[model samples]
Target chain A: MITIEFIPFSQMSGLSTEQKIKKILKSVKSDKIVLLQGKLKKDEETELIKLTMSMVNEKFHGIEPAIFSPEIKNTGNFLKFLKEKFINMLLSDRQGITLVGPANLIKEIKRDPEKMQLLLDLNVSRRKKK
Target chain B: MLDKIRSALKSLFSGFFKKKKQLKLGLYGPPNGGKTTLANKICKDWLGEEMGSVSNIPHETREIKIKEQILIKSGNKQLTFNLVDTPGIATRIDYEDFVKAGLDEEEAKTRAKEATKGVIDSIKWLDSVDAVVVVLDATKDPLNQVNITILGNLQAKKIPVLIVGNKIDLKRADIKKIENTFPQYKVVGISAKYGTSVEDFYTELFNLVKP
Candidate 1:
């Protein structure tokens, strides 16, 4: 069975970049998809990918990550855009949803400004059955 | 009149002595998207030297390679810069994928490890570059996450970007799809292998790095 875990921003608050990555990686390694309450900082995202690479093994492949920031839709409204940008600067964690899943389980994560489509690898279930 | 002549001479002498800051131009994209091929082509055209090897296997470039002081002449104007060819960025790397590409299990595992480091290094190098050339396969779907992530990061950093739709020699190549996918950036289509439309790429480079 596929497991999805929601991690609110409060849980990730006050954590260092490495700690946040470790927390996410721990869940991914356990075969659970992580639904993070807010997006990671740009550098943290890169670090997450880097850490994920080092931990790649026979059992754990890696991660497929996608972020959906609400600010993307506000681009058309100049005042709204400025307001969102200002708010983002004040907040410790930018408001958004970040999805991270084990690469072995998630085939693809297609994203646009409006929505995200997560495609699962049906072959994984077939292998499990065998 | 004498003072004006002295001033003119001083200006000319200063222009001759002043060195322009070398622009760092990076080639980035997904694995097997012909980034190394284009780097080699650019190097050969100006310096008569190749930067790195090329292979059909993905992640052939597992480390960042650079060639310095490449001067390209277009008409009477010349542009010189350091060319950085980075390993392709990907969301995932699997040793079994390498094994399927003809590598032994152990070799595949090692390659995968190096490739992961390569991706990290590529992302880090984004901070240091002045401008970037996003090399992509014209034949493949241009809307993949790897391409989006690379472009998004570049955008966030406000780095000047020029997209190159490579491998136009192939029948399946579709530069239009890439152009439509990214209407915000300038897209140039070329076959980095056969040197097709490469001159146009050089012309675009001049515009891309204009101060």
Candidate 2:
């Protein structure tokens, strides 16, 4: 059975933020894809890339979440690392999240996740207009 | 036996008469840096509630998430501290996380820009703060654009800043290296997971606001 945990924002209005994050990182069902994005600083972006790789490497049913970092000053060395991992992660300052996995899991997330979570934890959805 | 009962009754009566005070404190750090965990620990310890969520997912907090006033004590005085948690920040920018969250192209871009603005605003929140605690992951190095920018901003505002080197319990945590990097400030190395060194951290922070 698929496990879905909701982590509230740091405000602590509801779910646990860290547990929510861990769930998002681990909540890959089948062939659905994930993209984690934001205007993150250089270090933050690098940290996420590392987190995503480690999380994906674990046994979550044969899923791989690759990162494409921002543009690097020295393109040669950067490209070499990306090619090694089969991902051209440039290592820039922009914070982004990418997830590709099963469609059913994505649907379940849409049904239960919060808006701020959608913007912060999952992906940002455009539906609620107010 | 009669005296013991009388004393117990007096103590119980005084417990209800105790006054509570709250202090506002801000928790700042980059995305996925474990700032939320530290915040929750302080709150739950004092206020009986979790500080905030600790997540490995970047940008787990997209806005300035504020916790209610937490009543903590400093010496003979009891004060309530308001812990403010904010979104994770970074230099490079991307909207993919938004897209994966299921946003359209135009809206995702707008939200990305708005969230970036929020992070910038949170950094400036340091200026008016009573005191600021910067959470640096011990598993990572100290040098980065966001770190430098934040430190520079705090110094410019003449804010009393404390460095919290969290996750020191991790095997790869290089606490000494972090201290050596930012020698100009007060740094405390602690493992938030084990509750080690938090007392020292709290004391150091309490000393600044003790009135």
Candidate 3:
């Protein structure tokens, strides 16, 4: 079975950076793929990488990270916010909602609607093999 | 079909024997040290196009930008290489710092996250590079930990490196200090923005990457 969980930006604010990473690690360790909205803060992400690298060993398939920018919502005229719009357009490939989890559990990732669509496909393919 | 197969076999044999002539050169440095500026100057002079955008804001290039197959000529010598311009390497990345630079809290956090990833990506790219140009701000102290870490890593890998003291046009710029700090390596100073002494930089790079 493929499991995907989305952690919103607001939900992460209450936890300390270390606690937040530990929480993410717990999910990843349990074979649950995490789709984090707005991405992790820099320090937290660094700490997570350090923890992963230190604990890496047999049975821990390496982490796979993928980022995809979700479409932004705004109510301003396209002409007025042209610069912001252009930056956002360019950033579509640069920044995004980041996903991280064990590689064995995820077959592929696509940056589109149903961000977890690949997981469902993986589950189907695995069932077919069985 | 028989002739095609024979020619293909011949080319495959030639590929195995031919030495790679183009080097994969990386431009690595601390944030705001003008890596992209140097990349732009080199690209403009040779390829007639820019590699990527540049900004006064730190970590503006939060991605690995590449320009391929640039050929540089100096005297009777010629060097052809693929250039990789990496994000500035920093010891610390803070979202609050971005907020101070006039970005909103959410935007600051996003930028910080991307910048951090860029740093890691740059470090990983070191493995694939044939040589490196370690760019430094001529106005800053060259004895800092970040510079040392980068040099130590490059040295450990046994990769050839050329130290560049960029931004020589600034009033506070000092190339002699950089030369004194790293006496073992050849140091060339240049104003990447104005393209000053860039020919010397290219000549030194060709010499450093010589097989």
Chain A TM-scores of each predicted structure, in the order given, are 0.85, 0.29, 0.62
Error of 2 at A99 (Å): 32
Best by lDDT: 1
Write candidate 1's Cα lDDT for B35-116 as tens digits: 9999999999999989999999899999999899998999888888999999998878999999999999999999998998
In terms of TM-score, how similar is model 3 to the real structure? 0.59
lDDT of 2 at B175: 81
lDDT tens readout by residue for model 1, A1-130: 7889999999998899999999999999888899999988777777887788788877788999987666444657899888767887787464878899999999988765566789998777578779
User: For all candidates, what are the clash counts?
Assistant: 0, 57, 0
Range of the 10 consecutive residues with the lowest summed lDDT in candidate 1 chain A: A67-76
- lDDT computed for candidate 1: 0.89
Between candidates 2 and 3, the one scoring higher on TM-score is 3
Candidate 3 segments exceeding 4 Å error = A1-130, B1-18
Stretches off by above 4 angstroms in model 1 are A71-94, A113-115, A125-130, B1-20
Q: Which structure among the candidates has the greatest DockQ?
A: 1
What is the Å distance of residue B18 in model 1 from its true position?
A: 8.8
Checking candidate 3 for backbone clashes, the offending pairs are: none
The CAPRI-style docking tier of model 3 reads incorrect
Task: Report the lDDT tens digits of candidate 3 across residue range A22-112.
Answer: 7777787777888777655444454565455444433453355554445444657767467667877665433457677764566444433
| Residue B70 displacement in candidate 3 (angstroms) | 0.5
